[model samples]
Target: MSKKIYSVICGTGKYIPTNIISNEVFLNNHFTDNSGKTFSQSNIEIIEKFEQITTINQRRFADDNLTTSDLGWLAAEDALNSSGIERESLDYIIFAQNFGELRHGNTGVDILPSLAARVKKKLNIVNPNTVAYDLLFGCPGWLQAMIQADYYIKSGEAHNVLVIGADILSRISDPHDRDSMIYADGAGATLLTSQTSNTPTGILTHKTRSDTLEYSEMLFMGDSYLPENGTKKGIYLKMHGRKLYQYALKHVPGAIQDCLNKSGVLLSDIKKVLIHQANGKMDDAILNRLYKLEGDLSVPFDVMPMTISWLGNSSVATIPTLLDLILKNELDGHKIKKGDKIIFASVGAGMNINAMIYQV
Candidate 1:
């Protein structure tokens, strides 16, 4: 048997902001319909219902002084330091984010310099060949970047890569929209390096699905719900919450199954399902449906680790952040040992859904 080169996660790190925003922050938001019509329910009632649905009490927000690139740099530095690999040896730096860097109080594209480029500059890598680029696949961006890194390794185009998932939804969310409560700011990163081994380890098999024709606008930017909040020209992250939820329920589980089938890995062998923390109720339903498909009604308590309850949904950052936490033993009762098979899956803005199975 010949050895094959695979992309293995060599290091992991994350940056969770110190500023905590709680549900109370939205208690006085005066949320309204798309036409600026005020809600009939009181803020208290709305928050209660939100908590019941999303199980999110609070989330982090980068300090007003920080930018999305700053968060990415922090996470990248942590991952780089942990890997103990020379910075000049990195072949690529992939920064996964959606709305560029729209800092607090300044709602601008700020995309002149890609976040990856900015992060690379911050890292001060003198190597001109360490190609830096940004990706915009919405919440699944980070996972997608990892998949790309795997390709680079398997194809022998690259050896070491820095994949960073960082986003600051706080700056892009419409303050008048209740959905804003589900958005958060955080960054997480992983270092993937090429390795040759006879055993099936690291990244094994992966699958991705995109349903844009019908669900293209399921999650997109639009004018604020409350017209009085700002100029009509200003836009923010908006979503057809119900439609998106339905789409995830209909497709995400199947996508997971596709990756499982591709890898020939049984559901019983996967010790962890590090799924995107979009919404608590939605995640619960997705996992339940997935387990049910395996003829098992009970989902093992540790099978799916989550951070949405306190971290909210930081778009691309969710999965990597959750993985970093568990691997570092920061998420209580969750730990992955050598040879543990885990699955990473996500569904987000592109109406994109993906799943990957990895052995650690």
Candidate 2:
């Protein structure tokens, strides 16, 4: 009988920019409303409320000279170097991103040369047969890419694949908007290779869903009035936080449960859940709900590893970066061992929600 093929994670890497912006920085800058009036005490309170809700203290911003692909290349290089696989042997490159490249301080997304293709070139891979492409699946893009790569390995269509998630959301944020505090920049990558084994040890089961028909406009980027110049049209990332939060609360738990059920893994078997670093309070609530579903009210304090306190929300890069940090022993008190079960989940634009089960 043919050996059972599994796509296993061999290496992981991440790149966080040097430029840091703290909450105090926003407090120092005067913000005004669209009606040409400065925010009053009520508006000031919103900033404090954001701090309570998101638990984001600070985030990094790419230097003016750096592009989205630049961040991605740095991460990809680290992943490739650690994988011990020759660059020429890579069978595919799957790049997941929301904003391609931020220009004019996040007002535009540059897509002329695809970010994936650029990273492939920057890596100096000489093989023309290695396929490279981009995936736009909101914040869950990286996990989705992994799902795709998992299939390729299982089907014997490829031996190795690189999955990357990176974004410079700080460029496209409206500084005057409170939501600006929630966006940041970074990139993360992982290398998955096929291995013949008697038992499955990689991605066990996964599920992804979209509700764009009803919630398409919940989280998005489009033309909005720049507070600096009321008449000029500028693009910025916008979201109805409450609606998005509600949607996540309602759907994410079901997705995770469905994934667990499909994989035939019990809730007690999961060691950690690496969810997208979107909002701290909301994430905790999602975990609480998931635990309740298992008929347990007690939630482990360390089950979910978080980087949003410093990383903010880098869209697709959040999960991979957090995973890399934990795997490298950079995150305190979190460790993975063989036979450990983990769950990955995220919700983002396109009103997309997804989750996956993996064994380490």
Candidate 3:
């Protein structure tokens, strides 16, 4: 029997931040359209409708003194502490992020050294062979990094990989943009070690798709909705919410289904789904549509676990954070056991969609 090497998650950690910003925080925000025209609806009306759609009631924000790199470093530290793996043994440190390091009130982002490098420095790892780098694949960045790490482990190029997803979306979010309420700050990290076995375990198969022809601008950076804000103004994270929502519902399901097929796994065997928490309703629709494609198979009551309501959409952080919580038994009524089949899927800024079928 031939043995195959797979990347198994040896440790998981998350940083959810201490500052809680509730929906009420936006009550005084003067949300405006791209053209700078204020919405006719009252802030209360807007917030209620936003909550109803995104199901985000509150979210965490990093302390003013912390930057994106700090979040990644903290989560990486936690993962390393839990794994009991010597820091010098790591072969790679991949930091999945988009916004880089934007201070609380600063419009500029600091990414010259790379967040991974910063985290490596923070951990005091001196191995130049570790190869620290950053990946900016939007919200799917973390999962994509995991896929890349899997490749490294399978190719025997790496024995241990540290994948960290961190972002302070609150810093890049335009206060005047209604979508700002959906963004948050958080980080999550995982340590993957190579395991050779006859049985297929850990990451089995994955799929990715990019629809950039027309969907390229679903999520982008643009000037704040407010024409005049007292804070230093520059491009902030913006999205065509309606278009992104529609695109996700249409493509995410098929991408996941394709991944399932690639693994030759039955949809019925998928015990849990840890998907990007971009939006609560959109995720619900994606799950429903996915099952319908498989002959209206009923979704198990706890098939999907979500933390969007409290965590908001922290870009690359969302999926990994959900994963850490589940693995640590921090999420109620959700747990992944050995031999469990799970799906990790994400759709984000590249108009990109990806999914992977994994076993534990």
Candidate 4:
């Protein structure tokens, strides 16, 4: 009388826009130092360092008119088609996004029904009870959705679940902020369902931690529409880099250890560490602590760096996009294989960290 287990029968799939923006163009034209220093020399250093560290060489961005929803739909289509799960058959869709249009006086949950209805119509589905909703947190939002979907399916409330983690992070980042220079826009989705074995295609073990006291360490607020003044329409995302890194460095390693212990896996058992690409340096530091790698370039030895430079940081979409790239021959030389266990961990606003163990 053991509990029923669920696994991803089909592997992951991804879709990135066709536009490729090189770091050189982004740095030279879009950024300049306070002293008006053009990024000629420093840009090379940044690109070289990124090249030496991760496997990523380039990243994609949606065209000027595309939003997170567009990327979400494309990625979802690829995932559903590749996963062999009919979109119409999906009993639930848990969409996690940190950036999008938020209606005044309403939570994203309120607008989710409409979006779900649209997706159903696009796919020509007729199910009435196939629930859809948005999960908002930050980088950990996607991981949070996965954990919740597991509970729903296991409880017999859902037969099939599509867990999508997406973001248009560039929409929030200060276009002029150098610290936020790497921010990019993208989306990715996954298919999860009930199965009879510990196939390990989906969630193996997941955990979350929050330090509510440090909640305001990072945040976003849109323009005020109040009155006599000319109306300004725009959203702004901010980060306290120093404080965030401090909390992340303090909590993430422990989170990884705890997840590994719970899953009865070891650090060495992980074939590739698909961590959320916040930055080249931050990801490296976390891996250094977790693996006892005594250096700042731990990522060069462990994670995918090329994607970071090429794709910048897609926030919550980072890991899945990287996973997609790896699957699509963008990672080069290294490929995910069956029986391999991959560890994915993410840290973001709300000062939260979530780690999941995935077996391929």
Give per-residue CA lDDT, model 1, range 246-348, as digits (tens).
9999999999998999999999899999999989999999999999998775788879888998999999999989998988889977999998999999999
lDDT of every predicted structure (CA atoms): 0.91, 0.87, 0.91, 0.67
Off by over 4 Å in 3: 229-234
Query: How well is each residue in 1-360 modelled by candidate 2, as lDDT tens digits?
Result: 556988899999999999988787787655555444566656457668778989998899888888889999999999998889888999999999987766544445587578889999999999997899999999999999999999999999999999999998887776666767899999999999998888878888999999988899998765443355453464678888889999999999999999999999998888999999999999999999999998875887789999898889999999999989988899987898889999999999999999999999
Give the per-residue lDDT digits (tens) of candidate 3, residues 134-231.
99898999999999999999999899999999999887888888988999999999999999999999999999998999999988888777756465
Candidate 1 residue-wise lDDT at 74: 95
**Model 1 worst lDDT run, 10 consecutive residues:** 226-235
lDDT of 4 by residue, 47-70 (tens): 555555543456566676665666
Can you give the TM-score per candidate against the true fold? 0.98, 0.95, 0.98, 0.81
Better of 2 and 3 by lDDT: 3
Pairs of colliding residues, candidate 3: 339-360
TM-score of 1: 0.98
lDDT (0-100) at residue 291 of candidate 4?
76
lDDT of candidate 4 vs native?
Answer: 0.67
Overall local distance difference test of candidate 3: 0.91
Clashes of each: 1, 2, 1, 8
